[model samples]
Target: MAGSAARELSFLTISFDERLVEVGSNKCRDAFRELFDHFAPRLKSFYLKGGSEEAAAEELVQETFVLIWRKAALYDPQKAAASTWIYTIARNLRIDRLRKEKAMIYKEEEFFATKLTTHETQTDVTYQNQMNTQLAQAIAKLPAPQAQVITLAFFEEATHSDIAKRLALPLGTVKSRLRLAFTRLAEMLEGSKQ
Candidate 1:
């Protein structure tokens, strides 16, 4: 395995570290693909040596490559060789994966525990309904013009400019109406809590 890795590293035709640098500065996909082709199988073997199954090894290898892609800009060729940097990423990911697997507390009744928690969901739904009622009452109190703008802006998901266009009002008028409407709604909602 050691001999194979050494031969593979030596077989890279281009300056692998330089290619990594290119990937960092330029986001060159082809450079990344080249790195992937060279390092993935070797990393897979290393993961398998650590007792990961084939699927786990492949997942770890893929995760390592993803980390390498995201953190390529942090890689310094002067500080470490490309192989060393890539291996470090693979090692870290595998360690994290193993930690997560071991961290899981196996409670066979865990699913049942979640299923039994209906009161919390019921409380959430009740709170949501109360808020909705307060909101509807507050909106009903808005003057017709302000309510129109609010309806368009909130319920219809229209931007201020779109509201302005739909109402044939100036942009400043639309903004002012929205500001006034929001201010009134805030005051009403705050007063309701008291």
Candidate 2:
């Protein structure tokens, strides 16, 4: 069994290397097709065994062949076997993908960091203090029940159900009070703006 397997591998190496040369020199579609058919599954298995997920394995195989097609003219059977050339392409593609993913994560973190810093540095502390004072006055002007729901929902970060349970009120009652409080706050804030 091992001997037969070795024979088959030998045959594949010889033919696939020749096919790659054919593809490079003649732009031969048939040779390219043969190479793709033989190597795609093997490349996918290689990636999967290297800890890539199935979908990622398939993607890497596709990218490797596309690259192999484009770069076939650069392949030199004198330097390496066809399988070696293909696997090297696949490995490079995987490394490129990992680099891109890492770069995206780094960019996202950088963006958020800059955004937070800008907001903090550019804020008008006096304006913020004034708005807080106005908001407090407006809440005090709300009827007791409406203020309670608003405070619980916004300040304490309670859900409507939790606010209702805390206040011994129905969920619907909590929602209505929050809506009314929002309307009053909007009017008061708008009036102050004018």
Candidate 3:
């Protein structure tokens, strides 16, 4: 009985090893399917035992199989059994996933560490409010034609050609109006600062 069990074990190992070699040489889907069917469940169990969540374990299994398919040509029976090589791939993939997760967490912690505080947010809002008020007063003092072009170009984000088409003016007339509007607004805002 002991002799028969040893023979069976040896046969199974050789069979899988041969199948893996066939996959490398021939790109045989049938052999790959058999390997996947045999190892996927066991690999999942291994990952679960290693504290991976169900989803993460499933991902690791998928990544391992993909690598197996891609790197089958690199396998050497003299270096390791097929099972040992496959499990090593899974282990390395798990380590990579953990490193990426750790990096994302570190980035989040760094962003929070340097984030603007409530006081800074309030001061920014106050400064923005003052600028808006001053800009509104300056715009209100602009002549109607210049104000119209400024409103269309800056507020409505219209192109100069579009503003000329809308206002039934020449393109050069539209450009001059925008330039004059900017100059007047700058002078008004500069005087307000004093």
Candidate 4:
């Protein structure tokens, strides 16, 4: 409606950066509409100059406005002028769309790729999950001292020396427990396989 358009212009009374901050803090639809009014045409022209179809340019403008709304809080006036920052966002989004289209083209070319490969990948994932479950069960079966050492070494990704420091144990003691734990796990897994 003409009333909506007039309201959009009313927002021009404030600076663009202040409007963006208002979008950030208040999520005001009128402020957003104002921003859309100001930027959408300029963005469309920029896109058209770079060879986008009219519909695609319009879509990009809509998407850019959406980003402005959602990511308003991330805007910092100290970094760059509002126009420069907004232009950068639109440019990045366009590049991303082009890259995604290229990637999808490659994906489409792989449509004839074998179901056998997909099945094998699924089977490999299943096997890995089962092995992880069995290994966790085996670790659980271990005595507390051995389990503690194994957990610190593998689960927590602590080096043996780090484990020694964390647990206030001697390095030799930590190494011995780890050796015993590994031997027990090998035996347990072998029994489960049989």
Candidate 5:
């Protein structure tokens, strides 16, 4: 009797999934409008809770629905409900944005440290000066090839194989350079305290 009840519940769930897929596939605009109308507030709250600004959260919500329109055909009714799939898309977009933001920040820091002139009198000067000195010292300590590999990996965001191809070096050589560079950097930082 319990087994029969579980089967019945599964059947109902499948039927709902199919209906949503059909709605998404055929009456796409109307289906999306309905979904957006229902879920917009929830999505805004979701993004806000996840630390996005209200304006950015609203934009992300809109982008999510736009993706739904484009990727509706890729939805698998057997795998998830419409709400779950939409939420997953929203979450993935947020994570992608965060990664890009982090990469941009790192690039900016690298650029400013290299390009900006130093004025020793400013209050902000002390920290920037220390960072610049440490970074230069670290890079200087690395062997030329190892330093090149680390710079390409961190600044260009290249994979080991990509770095290998760019430098025309073997894959193992690129990996070795990265490992040796990081080890040297750690040791340099550690020794500087004494």
Candidate 6:
């Protein structure tokens, strides 16, 4: 009887282990949803304290979920809770957005400085005008979508994801457009150099 009891306990333990594995597989959505429902408000509070408006905070929350969905396969249950993983995604995305915004501001400043220097030189107005005309002609030759992508990426210093969101495009489409645009621009610039 004692031997049978031991055998029954071992079988029960094995069954529980299988059940745990099934639960692990099935629990991703539930885990993510619970994590989102719980931590979204906390994330909003964090963003608000960091000076984001309510709308921006909400947008960040949505972006965080999107990232979490994309990266859910990377989550390791042994390493962190779902909440920790989600918060880390949120924090990292916020940092990336802030850095991009700062870079955009810096680029604007540099462009302004370059314009000032160009104006002050005034020594080759005709040559500069010719170069400008060439550049305009090259840009005009690009397809409309390519032109638009280049404008947003270079002139506006928009990130690929930002441009994708702004243009209501997929991130893959944005990346492809930008790649094709750069290839075309490089070919044009290289031809002009010859």
Q: State model 6's lDDT.
A: 0.59
In order, the Cα lDDT scores of the candidates are 0.68, 0.70, 0.70, 0.68, 0.64, 0.59
Writing each residue's lDDT as its tens digit, candidate 1 over 30-125 gives: 999988887888777777766688998898888888878888887655444566567556655655664755324332122443456443433232
| Model 5 spans > 4 angstroms off | 1-20, 100-194
Which is the winner by TM-score between candidate 5 and candidate 6? 5
Q: Against the hidden true structure, what lDDT does model 4 obtain?
A: 0.68
User: Per-residue error at 101 for model 2, in Å?
Assistant: 12
- After TM-score superposition, the amount by which residue 10's alpha carbon in candidate 6 deviates from its true location, in angstroms, is 28
Give the least accurate 10-residue stretch of model 2, judged by summed lDDT: 120-129
**Which residue pairs overlap in candidate 3's backbone?**
none
Put down candidate 5 lDDT per residue, 89-110, tens digits, no spaces. 6666766786877544443332
Query: How do the residues 24-73 of candidate 6 rate in per-residue lDDT, one tens digit apiece?
Result: 56645555565566567877776665557899988988887776666555
| 19 Cα displacement, candidate 1 (Å) | 1.2
TM-score to native of every candidate shown: 0.45, 0.48, 0.49, 0.44, 0.42, 0.37
What TM-score does candidate 4 get on C-alpha atoms? 0.44
* Model 4: residues with Cα > 4 Å off, grouped in runs: 1-14, 100-194
| Candidate 2: regions farther than 4 A off | 1-4, 100-194
TM-score between candidate 1 and the true structure: 0.45
* Poorest 10 consecutive residues by lDDT, candidate 1: 121-130
Distance from true position, residue 184, model 1, in Å?
78
